[model samples]
Target: MLSAVLLSVLAVAGQEPPRDCARPNGHLETVACYGERREQVEADQRVILSRINARLDQLPAEGGVNPQQAKQSLEQAQSHWAAFVAADCRAGEALFGEGAAFALDSLDCEITHYQARNRQLAAFEARYGGA
Candidate 1:
């Protein structure tokens, strides 16, 4: 199960997902599909973040507004956000209990958070003059 999820993440990062997960027929497939979608969103977020960071790099340094400091802050925020997502998923798993649906609930939690983060990164990219 863990392997499948990891594969899905790696697959989406390097290439297209093996299948369209928008409509999965069973629990196993749904998990894989959600992993794919989550990773896809994550990949998109990385691109947007990179672009924004680059733009930040080009800004001239001013008193109390250092571009390097801004970049570091973004990096720290993203790392903390990732940790929060993992912990949040664990909380969801606990709420769902140890049942057949436990894994699904956790995956759903991850997917929801991934989508939200992607939206935030995308909006930031747009605000920074779109990329």
Candidate 2:
């Protein structure tokens, strides 16, 4: 049963596959594209995080808010957010059951979380001043 489902997913993904991710063919293809998009978002997040870190490093302890403490807080928030995203994706997979559908659902959740995080970082930069 699993093999049959896998083969079907492969067939759908391969059949007249789109040249770009904008038009994915099936659950498998969409999942692949989502994975690519997630990677790109993560890369962007890294660059943004570095800029934010640099800005944080320049700020002195004003009003009892230490620069090191601020940096640590940001790190802890990001770490916890990542764990939540992973757990959410796992929940999505379980919701969809055992198949390619499950994989696609998980990828969808991941892409959503990555995009949301990137937006959050952008907003943070806007508020705190960063590239």
Candidate 3:
């Protein structure tokens, strides 16, 4: 009986407790870190999309974009964005909880906005040379 109780106590002590994402410094750091990383990813996406758009826009209307080249650029952008999002989501889950609604929502929103910007840039490029 004593051995059983001791074993139970040890097991409980050995288990890692969940992190509280609400602690002042920790929570703030978590939020800030995610924000910074998300911003960096957004910046990179913007650079690529901007270049692609500028190129598209520069092409004469009579000699529009090569469909294959456009498709490849889009695929590359999407792959990069997907990788960034996966990494971000993993970090968020580790900092917050698996079911952290707010953190997940914020991350999704950031990605969504970035994608929208990318689309807009593509449209701009299609209209003008990628300058």
Give per-residue lDDT, candidate 3, residue 90: 61
Q: Which stretches of candidate 2 lie over 4 Å from their true place?
A: 1-19, 25-27, 62-65
Q: Model 3: per-residue lDDT, tens digit, 1-131?
A: 12123234434556445434455245434544445445665786768665765565555545654745765676686778667756655665566554435553455556565766566665655564433
Q: Where does candidate 1 stray beyond 4 Å?
A: 1-22, 128-131
TM-score of 2: 0.76
N/CA/C clash count, model 3: 10
Would you list the clashing residue pairs of candidate 3? 53-125, 54-129, 54-130, 54-131, 55-130, 57-125, 57-128, 57-129, 58-128, 58-129
Query: TM-score for each prediction?
Result: 0.76, 0.76, 0.37
Task: State the TM-score for model 3.
Answer: 0.37
Cα lDDT tens digits, model 2, 20-41, are 7888776656766766666687
Counting only residues 3 or more apart in sequence or on different chains, how many pairs clash (N, Cα, C under 3 Å) in candidate 1? 0
lDDT agreement of model 3 with the native: 0.55
RMSD of each: 4.4, 5.6, 14.5
Model 3 residue 7 lDDT? 32
Cα lDDT for residue 94, model 3?
60
